[model samples]
Target: MLVGYARVSTQEQETHAQTDALRNAGVGFIFSEKRSGGSMAKRPALEEMLTKIGAGDTVVVYKLDRIARSLKDLLIIIERIEAAGAEFRSLTELIDTRSPAGRMFFQIVGAFAEFERELIRERTRVGMAAAMRRGVKMGRPTAMSEAEEAEAMRLWFTGDYTKIALARRYGTHISSIKRAIKRYRERHQPSLLDAA
Candidate 1:
């Protein structure tokens, strides 16, 4: 029995192409979804497909990355398939776990995948650090504007609004409101550094 799995990282990505490829490969049953490959928990279809496999069954996929986000994840899924007495196959990469050479090649591919991921991560960190060095902020923009923070601080000081109320009004968190209040107090109060 050939059971296929197809996946896309986002809803914007089309899965029909992968589905067609899997079907053309003579896969009778296919499970597909648009879900992030970042983690197993994010892909329910993949999890369900794994549970349905049995001895002599071959699990097919369009590509390795469609079923796995990282080398560790790929190995984990392959281990499960092997434990279930099933085989694994990738259409594009032409990997068939039934052969000894294919198994060794799969491991090599995993090593290359891990290496590629590390390179990407390193590049991203270096780029972010460079942006920061250039005085560019490198995170989500504040939900509450500076003007809104000032208004929240004023309202908080007037004792007219609660922390939760301020957060809801400004579409922010109670923690953010607290931080704004703290900043307001620090600015208003005389610091020891200023005294010195």
Candidate 2:
């Protein structure tokens, strides 16, 4: 059995080209999904295809990167396929992992993928650090202004509105309201240990 998997990152994208290629390659069962290949949990069709394969079966893809986000991820998926006693095949890369030469090519590709990811991560970290040193805010901005937060806390204490209602009114979340209240008490109120 030659089981195929095709994927695209977003709803606007289509997997038609990949599906056509896989079909032309004579793959009998092709699973397709329009999702970013970032997380394993998000690819249920990929997981199902792997789980359904058995000995003497082969897992096929139009391209290796279509199914894997990084080298570690690709290797992990191959490990799962191998554990199921199945072979791995990629059409564009001409990789058929049942053969020694094909395995070497796969390893070389995986190494380059891992190196590329590391370089990207290093660049992002350097950029963030540089921004921080220049006094630029690095993360998400606050959800509420000081006056609004104060009013929300006052309303909460006076039992005029529930946290959910206040969140809706302020266009924030219950979590933000709760965090504001907790911070306020921690600053002004004595702890039980201090009272003791």
lDDT of 1 by residue, 2-43 (tens): 999999988556889999999999999999999888989878
lDDT of 1 at 68: 92
Q: Which stretches of candidate 2 lie over 4 Å from their true place?
A: 7-26, 32-44, 69-73, 172-196
User: For residues 118-185, could you state the per-residue lDDT of candidate 2 as single tens digits?
Assistant: 89989999999999999999776768898888888888899889989989999998888888888778
Q: Candidate 1: global Cα-lDDT?
A: 0.90
- The lDDT for every candidate, in the order shown, is 0.90, 0.89
Error of 2 at 168 (Å): 2.8
